[model samples]
Target: MSSSQPSPSKSAAQGPGSPIADAAPLSLSAREPHVPADRLVAEMVPPPRFDSVRFDTYIPDPKQPSQPEAVRVLSAFAAGLGSAPSAGKRRWFGKKAPAKATGPRGVYLDGGYGVGKTHLLASLWHATPAEPQLKAFGTFVELTNLVGALGFQQTVATLSGHRLLCIDEFELDDPGDTVLVSSLLSRLVESGVALAATSNTLPGKLGEGRFAAADFLREIQGLSAHFRPLRIDGEDYRHRGLPEAPPPYTDEQVTRAAHATAGASLDAFPELLDHLAKVHPSRYGALTDDLRAVCLTGVAPVPDQSTALRLVVLADRLYDREVPVLASGVPFDRLFSDEMLNGGYRKKYFRAISRLTALARDAKGLVAQ
Candidate 1:
């Protein structure tokens, strides 16, 4: 027994006859598997504005009166989206039965600034299925840009593939945009695309005195009829510690900014300004329409007065549109120096700081962590 080596295992004794010995070696293939063209295209599409916003991260502030209602409405909306028909079913059954003939299911969230309207909208967008062709998220400004590029019927045809279309910064300031959006909303709903939108204005009050009140009403009335209005009233979460001051920018500034930015290039802010300056009298409000969110990277102190002024205008435009900004490389408070803030544009610079701080805070809320 002392001299005996450990008995060879059965497989060792069996040698090549063992199951383990006969098995093929595992190896990675040189070529990757093919991805479908549609899948590739889906991957290439720009992500939704609130791609990171999800239900799990949304904490309804227990202290806010409107938080409960917002939570309930968001839950209902998410459930509705999740339970909506799949692409195959939507194509076959939705058309044959025509769901929208009875009226499409829609929700309109009306709330004050920084009350988490965008957060809720982003959450709804994220809750929808990952089929890029079946969902879209953008502001009304971006919608108009699509229409301008693709034309009305083509835009409708393109967006028709989506089961849901979510619009943020919903406003009826521009008569032309109002008409186009109202018509587009109706057509989309009729095509079985559901709508979810957030706005500061009530449906009835949209474009009240700016356009022919009756005409404006007529255009959006049907569109508004489709939605169950849910009011989200809460403190401006962005301005918690700030002193109470009147909004520096007026409704006229907002409308003008929207109109100016509507036609500007959706490329970059500088390019947008260049394009707008060519066509419009002033480029101050030009980037508002297409500027959904702002990200300031390598944000050294603004180098020159011209650059500082441009940034002030950009902040104003962004603030008026209720678009959130994110800054890195420097604190937003340090974006402009004492020299810049002490100039003739001091008040404007101060207002920019105030508004941008709020927008940045709101943007922070949008991040899941």
Candidate 2:
């Protein structure tokens, strides 16, 4: 984990009244994570942050009745998956599509960011009566990436045996994804694989303003049929009782802290964003292996949509790992342009801001006053 950049000299830190620390730091830009297909499938379980979460651990906001109701319904749904499917029903290949399920085969938790939808979804995953291998959990992007890594048919064959699949941050921003996932889930449902998902958008409402969704109505409708929607209403819980995120520290402070902190990675913000563009979104998790805090100097607004989306994925991985972010220059709120903020992918951008802000709060102690 040696840095790609040179270590700041000890004299720099000792310079008349400087708070700089004198240790070398790791560099994220120096690492190019290679995630094999097998690893993608193996890592489909909940991210570290939610690995230990369970139904009882989700404290439903007393004011949001839907929160508790979601838990109750999901708990029952998990219980319904207690019986394993017969071996004959395990295979999804070379079979006629089974009869349309009499009722919804899945539960979709719809809510705003930080409403604990992910927590509840992961809780259901943990509560489900199945072995870890029998259950799978991942974000929508990861699911699609898995399909891309393993061809669509292979993806179906691989997941068809699972008793349950939990999808967090479900989205339909692209038409191809709508078609691919709808077909995949249909096969899974036919194989008796129960499903649970969480998203900022409801199943039916996904892709409304993101694309030419009208043309994909059939695919969208078919996808919606597999899930029963449950709405949870509440303020963004990340900042509900938390203080404002600390302002960006000085570049010297950020660099000093990166050097001082073990397992911390140092990078110029712009270079890190450029590095992200070259890495596939699915491998972003791997890009952060064994790292502690992320220290970025010259934080600024993303130049365009593609880069912003990549950053969103990185933010998600960092938040999933509960890694603190220490940065200089512009804050997370200003990371996207106003046009991007008002555009179709606004929810994704806002969620990134929320998560990054939380990580920034976690890094306040890294800055030397």
Candidate 3:
């Protein structure tokens, strides 16, 4: 599969011959340029290290969640739940916490891609108070890479920085990952880090894929031992397209976005923005800035208690503007399509992403016409 990693068909305009490289060597360069010009030019370009690593690579905010309403929900759940790990102790009691949820408290984000699972998780990380020292991200793919880069012991040592972790996209994708997942959780419990995740599949989705449904079930049976799963119920926000957040001015930004992203249908977007901009155009452009910040930075910093960072801000923008968005994706509002992943090891992830094109088209104005 790595052999088939897609190379960028297009490239952005960089300095002549491109002055960037593996970044590692260039980063250590002395104040003065000592390397020969020939070598400098030759080493300035290196294919990204993660060319074959998709699941763990950084995602642009356009492809991830960008608002905060969901973060508050998860944070409240976490606050009420506390940091004491329960999977081990619950085994002795042979019972469960009978309070808020019937199943688990750990957040479950089940939906089409670009709807904001990662965004929601990131927001929760930023929204949650500093008491637990929550460290967001450190996704499954990233964790695997860490284990590869640094042995398991060193990986665990790195994770020791935070007591609370909001893990994004966690599943036993492969045997290697299963070992890591099992080991990570068991240790996190020992260290006391609450887990929160966004997934396309429910617990049972894995076993069905491998035809080892029994072993899969056994692995996850108590996986939610300390928490319950919370599903992100909705269409992909990305499909909804630039929810009337901010207005674009110059052609360059829009052009850059279009050139960098393939098959994004941004041509169809300006007209959509034109229609909405006519209604809610503002001079301050805070909403636009917020939206653009997420898009440009590719990282939506969770706002304080007063606001959210996910695309929900756009939802609010539309709500305030009195608009509503509709969906056109795989329509999981009825079917659990996430249950079917065509790929192996990481089925839910592939399935969730596969639903993206549908998400962009399906989102309609949240406000009624």
Candidate 4:
């Protein structure tokens, strides 16, 4: 397809730096159909009317620029852009423009998953219309695969022209990921781009076990020099979607599960279940209200690694300055039938739920679905 007509001025003897001029026209041949350079460019850069953009453009508060917390964050983020040596060098603050960050603002917003982590940064992009910039969305995984070869360079060019950079779901699940984040972020910061990211782990918490976490932490800590850390405390905004998740649980399942284990002692489990509920209230509420959906019944024991780790911590709390006594709660059911999971001080995180349930029998009370 043909590109948008060049501006009248641009149509004149084209300058060397013009993107159109730089691209050689396609050479069509009998053997193959020529794809337009403009088409290729179109695919690489998102349009203005994208779903993310439309969703992000609402200023939660427009007066004095404070409609939403994201707007406030954007204002703070924008102010930091002013002090950035690299951002200042571009002098983009005066004009609505996007530029690469040889210098980038690496601010990470870490918190529990599904806590509107992505939405908060998204709101910043939508609210910062005064500073027009290219906004792209990518998770840690997507970035990892693209940080090398042509991917990183092209992404830079596409995003650089814009003054602000927004990244979402910045999880660091692997060691190699931490190292690359450091190298790339260092480059972006040097280029002078203002970056805002959302994650479920604190910058200090990232790559906790990985070799590169130290470097990642060192690089990110410098963010104190620019973007300020703002903890967003709020309810999960996710369930507010047009089509919300199904109701947490069915009535019959709850009653039946409750009736099935009326007299069971909940003494086997302790605060183990409580903490997960505390830190992840909605998830926990959903879990308890609908644990059967994931296949569960009554008070089960903590089996496998995930529940086991939780179990050990609970055991410590219950037995704090006291004797070792069985606590109670619904854990995984797989532990009872699985001989492999029968005995062990070490908690294997990935154990079967069934095993955990068999162990839950020690509880003083049993809960229904």
lDDT of candidate 1 over 58-158, digit per residue (tens) = 66666767666777767767667655563434665545533443443777776555667777877777676646567777655556666765688877777
lDDT (0 to 1) per candidate: 0.54, 0.82, 0.38, 0.38
lDDT of 2 by residue, 314-369 (tens): 99999999999999999899999999988878889989999999999999988776
Candidate 4 per-residue C-alpha lDDT over 20-77 given as tens digits, one digit per residue, 9 for 90 to 100: 3222221101011233323333322222223364334542323312225645555566
lDDT of 3 by residue, 229-334 (tens): 4434444454454433222223344334433332221222223323333322221112322111111111122222112112222332332222212222122222
Q: How far out, in Å, is residue 295 in model 2?
A: 0.2
In Å, residue 124's CA in model 4 sits off its true spot by 1.6
Which lDDT value does model 1 have at 91?
62
Off by over 4 Å in 4: 1-70, 76-106, 130-133, 148-161, 201-224, 239-369
Off by over 4 Å in 1: 1-49, 84-95, 98-104, 202-219, 241-355, 359-369
Candidate 2, superposed: residue stretches over 4 Å from native: 1-23, 84-102, 202-219
Candidate ranking (TM-score, best to worst): 2, 1, 3, 4
> In candidate 2, what residue range of length 10 has the lowest lDDT sum?
210-219
Ranking by lDDT: 2, 1, 4, 3
Give TM per candidate.
Answer: 0.54, 0.87, 0.42, 0.40
Candidate 4 residue 265 Cα shift, in angstroms, is 46
* Model 3 segments more than 4 A misplaced: 1-72, 78-105, 131-134, 202-222, 241-341, 345-369
Give Cα distance to truth, residue 350, candidate 4, Å: 14
